[model samples]
Target: MKDEKLLAILRLQKSKAIGDILAKKLIVNVGDVEQIFKEKSAILQNINGIGNHGLKHLFDEKNLKAAEQELNYIKNNNIKYSYFLEDDYPINLQNCIDSPILMFKDGNINFKNDKIISIVGTRNMSSYGRDFCTKIIEDLVQYNPIIVSGFAYGVDICAHKVAIKNNLQTIAVLAHGFEQIYPKVHKKYINQVNENGGFLTEFWSEEQPLRENFLKRNRIVAGISKATIIIESAEKGGSLVTADIANSYNRDVFAVPGRTTDIYSKGCNNLIKNNRATLLTSSEDIVKMLNWDIKESPKKAIQKQLFVDLNENEQKIYDLLSEKGQQLLDVISLECNIPIYQLSSILLQMEMKGITKPLPGKLFELM
Candidate 1:
């Protein structure tokens, strides 16, 4: 990319009022990101969602100076980045409406492997959570997935370490910038992590990890993968926030159930009870839910499963999916005369019965 283009992106990103969604709107409407800086403020304000508050920050001279400084830091440090409009941006993240318009990357990170999943949970993890985290990554090693996490304590670091042990790539998403690593104690693992996969962040070189930054970075952890797994979480934690973001993005979410009385288990159990996440027992659950083995199974397998017992609604959904090949969730609801609220449960039942499976973007078809 041209230096001027990069500078414009940095300037737009520096605008506190204009977030990713509105920034994308301005870029699309104006036909060029760089041109947004050149266009008259009155003309830019004419675009929908471009209010005075945002325009004030967009054209602020202080923001221009900050962008220039950050651009220099990026150049001096040889930092790598991805523009939302660029082809190199992660496809999964690109689909998220609120994903960062600009993101920084480092080390040996590669997007060639499409199998990516984010594992996150509480920092105060129990032995049970640790063992389960290790076992799942070991089992999934054969698939060579790129494990993603926040690189914090407990489940995040556990997932990263296990992935490296299995020789699988691992990505650590940072809430701060590359200039500093949080929890200075974990600094020892920095070299190993970089040699294994690398780091990613949307923050500038000197940004610190503030309380809200962790919440903000959760979306990237959720959006950059096929699914987000909560190994263990308390009643309230950042991992739960990541799970919510993943669900909002229409991606799969899985939670490991623990004993009801266990403090860390409350969140996972609630997610399962509320139907916000799938109850994960082992690696097979992840593989099956994400349809990782779909290619190995024969298409004829669908025909054999036709004899499986299904409820009236499940049968209706099965027949529709069987005939239509693959249909959107809304279309299935209409054709089967099932309300979306009711259809979601019916389809999940079919999935568990091995008669159907979900595809990305809420599409479904027979297994």
Candidate 2:
């Protein structure tokens, strides 16, 4: 992106009152991010949700100075970033409604592989949690998933280390800016994480790791992946928050159930009991639930028996499955343009006809 355009985005991001959703609205309505600045107040005020209070911050002189300083730091450091609307932005996160408009990147992070999962848990991880975290990542090495974590103590660091040990890409989502590392002790693993995967954050260079920032950071951890795995969590902790955020995003969340008496297990058990997350026992659950075990083969023409009757929607679904191989329920619904409520019944009907079979994780495939 051009300096001017990036600067405009930074300025918008720095605006105190205008958040990502409203910023997006302003961008879409104005037709250009930079033009939002050049447009007259009267014209911008005409846009819905753009009131006087928002306008005051949108053009705040202090924001421009801050944005410029940040921009210069970005240029000087040769920092990498992804604009929410850009092609480089993570696709999974892009689908999230509250994802950051601009995310900074470090190290050699790669999003080419869509097989990404975030693993998080209590910082006071127990032996059971540690073993499960290691075993799960090691088992998942075959699929070479990108392991994402907060780069904090306990489960987060363990996930990163295990991913590194398995030669899998592991990304650390930071609560603070690039200038400082939280828990400062984790600095030793920084080089390894960078070489193996990288770090990601939405904060600027000088941002600190505030308490609220950690809460906000959980959303990124949840939003950036296809699924979230909670190896262990206390009855109340950040991992639970991440799981909630993941659930809100309609992403799959898996919690490893443990003995109810165990402090760390309480959160996972509650998540399972409350139906907030799937009960994960082993890596097999993840593989099956994510349909990772299903590999796409060469597509061939549909071969249905002539005697079998099919409706329009069923035919559309059959064709899609035949072309794309196994697909998630949501993807099928989207591609077939069928409502989820209707799609479920249609899929059941197809299943009864021995045309399609359901897989774990709401995936469906032709039998």
- Taken over the whole model, the C-alpha lDDT of each candidate is 0.88, 0.90
Per-residue lDDT tens digits for candidate 2, residues 73-176, read 99999999999766688877766666788999999988999999999999999998999999999989989999999999999999999999989999999999
Which structure among the candidates has the greatest TM-score?
2
Model 2 weakest 10-residue run by lDDT: 298-307
lDDT of 1 by residue, 149-251 (tens): 9999999999999998998899999999999999788899888888999999999999999989999999999999999999999999999999999999888
Q: Whose lDDT is greatest here?
A: 2
Which residue runs does candidate 1 get wrong by more than 4 Å? 296-367
* TM-score: model 2 vs. ground truth: 0.82
The deviation in Å at residue 179 for candidate 1 is 0.9
Q: What lDDT is obtained when candidate 1 is compared to the true structure?
A: 0.88
Q: Candidate 2: where are CA atoms >4 Å away?
A: 298-367
